[model samples]
Target: MGIVRNGHEASDRWSYIRRFLGGVAGIADDFLGWWWRGKDTLSPAELAAAHEQWADRAEWRLAQRAEELASDRIKRYLVTSWTDSVAYTSRRLAAQARGELSEWIPQRERRPDLHTEARAIFADILTELNIQSQPTKEQSSVVHLRKAG
Candidate 1:
């Protein structure tokens, strides 16, 4: 959540209204609310576009944060691990032998966190760094009537 302050209101006409707006996640109703206050709700297409843009920025933020916080050695190890995972060598070899098309797609065989690698990594990094969590310096992407509508 973010606050919008009007320094020079000039008696501007604005109404504060919030919506969960789970449409971006393709779940119109969920506990994790995509809460944003605005004069109005966004059109479906516009909401999707906004989600895409926001997600890209969020990913970049995570990458930058990792580089800043992790040691050079840890960073190198992470780079190697990520690259190796993308190659999926076992699947590649399997495909060469069995010619299974599905082998091309990367699969997480067994993980503590099944659907979310980010959750696992977040916990791992925090443990390694001896920190609980770090708040983002940037403000949340609080959608507004202008940013969305």
Candidate 2:
């Protein structure tokens, strides 16, 4: 038989059991409360609004990216064209200055229309240069929206 101490031992054992059970109950209650708070509570309209806002932001970002790419392409084309034109003009002017045109073209043949060629080349260069200097329409197409506080 188990030892008995005037019911004191049984009482102490019951107290320890109660304390352990109470701690477990408190923990369970806290977990349930947290789970309830963490549950999805958004209405359909709220969810839809959030999605629409995300899509709008995405579209705006894509448009901005496209504009940036277009600007870069235009810049590269302009620079390359300008460099090629400068090289060609330098070679032609140097050859003409050195009187090497006769070697390239027969003297008996009518001289090639240098004035017309020069005018055409300069016009093309100037047109492209002017275009490079001006802002593209895409740059101005961006819409600025002020956020409401």
Off by over 4 Å in 1: 1-34, 38-40, 72-149
Q: Residue 148, candidate 2: how far off, in angstroms?
A: 34
By summed lDDT, which 10 consecutive residues of candidate 1 come out lowest?
8-17
- TM-score against native, each model: 0.27, 0.22
Q: Write the per-residue lDDT of candidate 2 for residues 1-149, one digit (tens) a residue.
A: 32233332222322212211112112211223322442234344433333333333223333434544475644534433443343344344344444446343331132234334445666888999999987666654543222321
Model 2 alpha-carbon drift over 4 Å, by segment: 1-71, 102-149
Cα lDDT, all candidates: 0.39, 0.38
| Candidate 2, position 133, lDDT | 85
Error of 2 at 63 (Å): 30
Best candidate (score: lDDT): 1
